[model samples]
Target: MATRPLTGTKVFLILVAFFGVVIGVNVTMMKLAIATLPGTDVDSPYAAGLAYDREISAAQDQASRKWQVNAHIERRADGNAVLQVEARDASGQPLTGLKFAGRLERPTDKRADLAVGLAEAGIGIYRGNAASVAPGQWDLVIEGDAKGERVFLSRNRVILN
Candidate 1:
């Protein structure tokens, strides 16, 4: 039996029809699934639990005085690093009478503990010198009081290079 060749139009029409049915079914199923799904309130129990966990962690940090210390480092052209630290309140304002001590620490090596105290450089700026810190990572610790209360804090892993 002789068979006529299928035209390009016939193939295109078949492909279009097949894709149309698939797309129609997908759209219908998507609509039905969305309509049947339960609404999730963002302030639900699960969300509240997450928020509570975050609050607890923050409270723990505050109790440990970890939130009081803010530390940073700047490198110079002489391969030396200037570790800058400013004691601050929770609102990030510089606090006076805060003592800061830092250390250049490396794993499996001797740690160099630097003794530095906050000095009034200018208006609301406190600076402490770190002579032992070089171009690498180090830790700067600031410990003192806002208004005669104990504040123990430490900052870690500041990159200088």
Candidate 2:
């Protein structure tokens, strides 16, 4: 059998093919990483740090008030997101008379985030409806305030199917 020699053209073709495959795979992985981010819990690190003192003070105040908050997300039948929140005092009494709000925020894209106004159902229960909440992971933020005071605040990580 006559074997072919390792000519310049063969070497060039081999190098091009190898680099093409490697570059293609690297680009694909980079795109995927940008698409699915881990999580962005805070918008601004500096601002959060500056407000750290106030946050701690507020938390202490809330602790003194002895309020407990429970928050979660529910996927509706219509492929929407429902934010549920419940609040209670340390004495195990329901807490009410507060305005409730929440957000279903994506880690990478703020454009895909959802904001909803939660309505008080009964006995410290609040519900909010959101549209087109695609199945994946989400950062849930629940806040309740009355007369310009932070009555309840919660951040919960949830996964949807």
> What is the lDDT of every predicted structure here?
0.60, 0.85
Looking at candidate 2, what is the lDDT of residue 21?
100
Clashes counted in candidate 2 amount to 0
Q: After superposition, how far is residue 20 of candidate 1 from its true place, in Å?
A: 85
**Where does candidate 1 have its weakest 10-residue lDDT segment?**
105-114
Name every residue pair that clashes in candidate 2: none
Q: Write the per-residue lDDT of candidate 2 for residues 1-161, one digit (tens) a residue.
A: 99999999999999999999999999999999988775566789999899999988887787788777888788877898878888888988988888999988776676788997999999889888999889888888887899987766777678888
Top candidate, metric TM-score:
2
RMSD of each candidate relative to the true structure: 14.8, 3.6
| lDDT by residue for model 1 (1-161), tens | 99989999999999999999999999999999888655543438977987888666755766754344455666667755565665556676766655445555542233344556556565445566555455555555555544555345454666666
